[model samples]
Target: MTTTQKYAATGAWNEPEGATPRGTVALLPGRGETAASYARLGRRLAADGYRVRYVPVTLDDIADARAAVEELLADESLPAPRVLLGSDSGAALAGQFVAELPVDGAVLAAIALPGSAHGEVGADWADEVDARTACPVHRAVLATDEEFARGAIASPLPWETIAIGAQDRPTLALHGTDDRVTPLAPALEVYARAARTDVRLVQGGRHDVLNDVAHRSVAATIVLFLESLRLSPEAPPIVTGLG
Candidate 1:
């Protein structure tokens, strides 16, 4: 029987229906967002046959989110071979979380670049920009956004710290080539520094590439990355249905 649990930190989590629990994938949301934001992605994963959970971490709920993940893993009702899907700020946190836990793999999307706060390429600029502009100039303009600045302050995890710990884990970074907020160049640098050989850079996409036209490609890449782990058959199926 499939089970659904509501955690104090995370909002709601759903497992596979009428099947033996295989594994768990914790989906973390971006800054200023709730776990509910991942509902569409979760539904797609569920349709593909994997038990999925959306872990919400509000501005002041990082501790709660971490505790909830630990507790969920400890619960006998959950499955084994856990994987993490973290987007934006959540990706950084997920990296930190796994440093202490037994995680199988991780999918990091739209990750902030190292030293981005002080660098030219800061997080901002959701809109398109001229490709001719230098990366440093473009990044500085992107970082000037008030919303992005606020999210940076609110985020509990730092990209540099996460990148350091991600060295040992088999990580897959899904970044948008035209991502103004989290530019692809800096993100790629961080991924490279992590020594992760497997990284996917999607072109003509923005920070929210998961919902963009590149979603199908993103989903496919995610499946392939997870398969490489060879941990278990518990990971959710790739979302082939492109809405």
Candidate 2:
């Protein structure tokens, strides 16, 4: 399936020719990231028949972001089993939406939590890039993307406003074990609140698990989770018998 891009600022990647869309993923980007930051992810998911929309989110205009998300979910052109996906602070925002919206499921990646020990704030751009991801391509993307927020990684998240309650719908939680931004322990604590949540760890990965070195594997895992969600929100494992 070929990937095609649409919309100017708010990017939309649609399913290939003649292929029916499997589902829709409305993604809220983390701090300082513009729609361009998720081009790779959008293409990958779109190739797999999932319509991916990069919904811009920022600490500055949250009410507008929530309104945009609601409008995207309301659009009938996007297929069913709609999933709210996000990373870092974006993940926190997605959690808030999952609590209030009628989304079919959620995918939370590299969730930044309040009171978490993120390394030195105001570090140089090099340090911030290294802390976020080790992939040269992603690092270059951050370096060159004029729209990307340089020191936004260290910016504080509004924990009070982003509280995630126990979710009744299926939730896929992904984190990097070696993440320097939001540590694994506290992120796990947040996921534990939901008993049925499926958690996956990216070993030796940094903060940006989605754009990390093992991004292909991460995308595959997300595809598996999305496929499972199509069957049921419980997300029954498609491949079983592993001991």
Candidate 3:
């Protein structure tokens, strides 16, 4: 069964049913994305016997993203051992929220690293930087990605701080080896600072890894990681080889 509801305080949310309610996995979409973007993934999780909640975050609602997450968790009516799955800007927001919440784990895809959007560069330099940067650069280079244009990049908060602060929580950082949007090098640096070992770099994968063929494997890995935590929240981190 699937149910769609409006989270007056957050935005729209889609809830999918499952047997025994394995647990709720809050799906946070990227910049300029709507809850519908996660429909496929949410439905997949729901079919896999896990309750899935897709949350939409827009530019105007970015500031309330964290609060919205808190509100979702406060419901108490949901199942236990909830996890957060976020991409792009949503990944950063998830990290910040987890630091204040009691989630069982998190899966971050196409995570933006600190300084990835900082510094001023000319169109030519931006183009050059995009070619050399680890994450996807087309968006940043073209200055069309709303996340960067809407002042999201200029925010003073550091990604390192958020990652490090959530050190104790089980986290899975998924990144595309050739992601030009969110450089992989800076993301790895932040992952290292957090001493996190559950990082996966998918080869030939782009920023929209969630929609790629590798999504199945990625989702399976995430489910396994969540299950491992369910059994032992303090289990040792399982790091997969970089693709």
lDDT of each: 0.59, 0.83, 0.61
Q: Per-prediction count of colliding residue pairs? A: 1, 0, 10
lDDT tens digits, residues 61-169, model 3? 5467777777778877667678888887778777656657778778888765555342322345344334323334323322442323333332333333445346777
TM-score (all chains, Cα) for each model: 0.68, 0.92, 0.71
Top candidate, metric lDDT: 2
Candidate 1 residue lDDT tens string, 188-228: 76677665436778888666555455676787677566655
**Which residue pairs overlap in candidate 1's backbone?**
124-181
Descending-TM-score candidate ranking? 2, 3, 1
- Over 181-243, each residue of candidate 2 has an lDDT whose tens digit, in order, gives 888887888888876678999999888899999999999999999999899877889988958
Instruction: Output the TM-score of candidate 1.
Output: 0.68
Of the two candidates 1 and 3, the one with more favorable TM-score, higher being better, is 3
lDDT score for residue 132 of model 1:
15
Model 3 per-residue lDDT at 127: 44
lDDT (Cα, 0-100) at 171 in candidate 1 = 73
For TM-score, candidate 2 versus 3, the one ahead is 2
lDDT of 3 at 175: 81
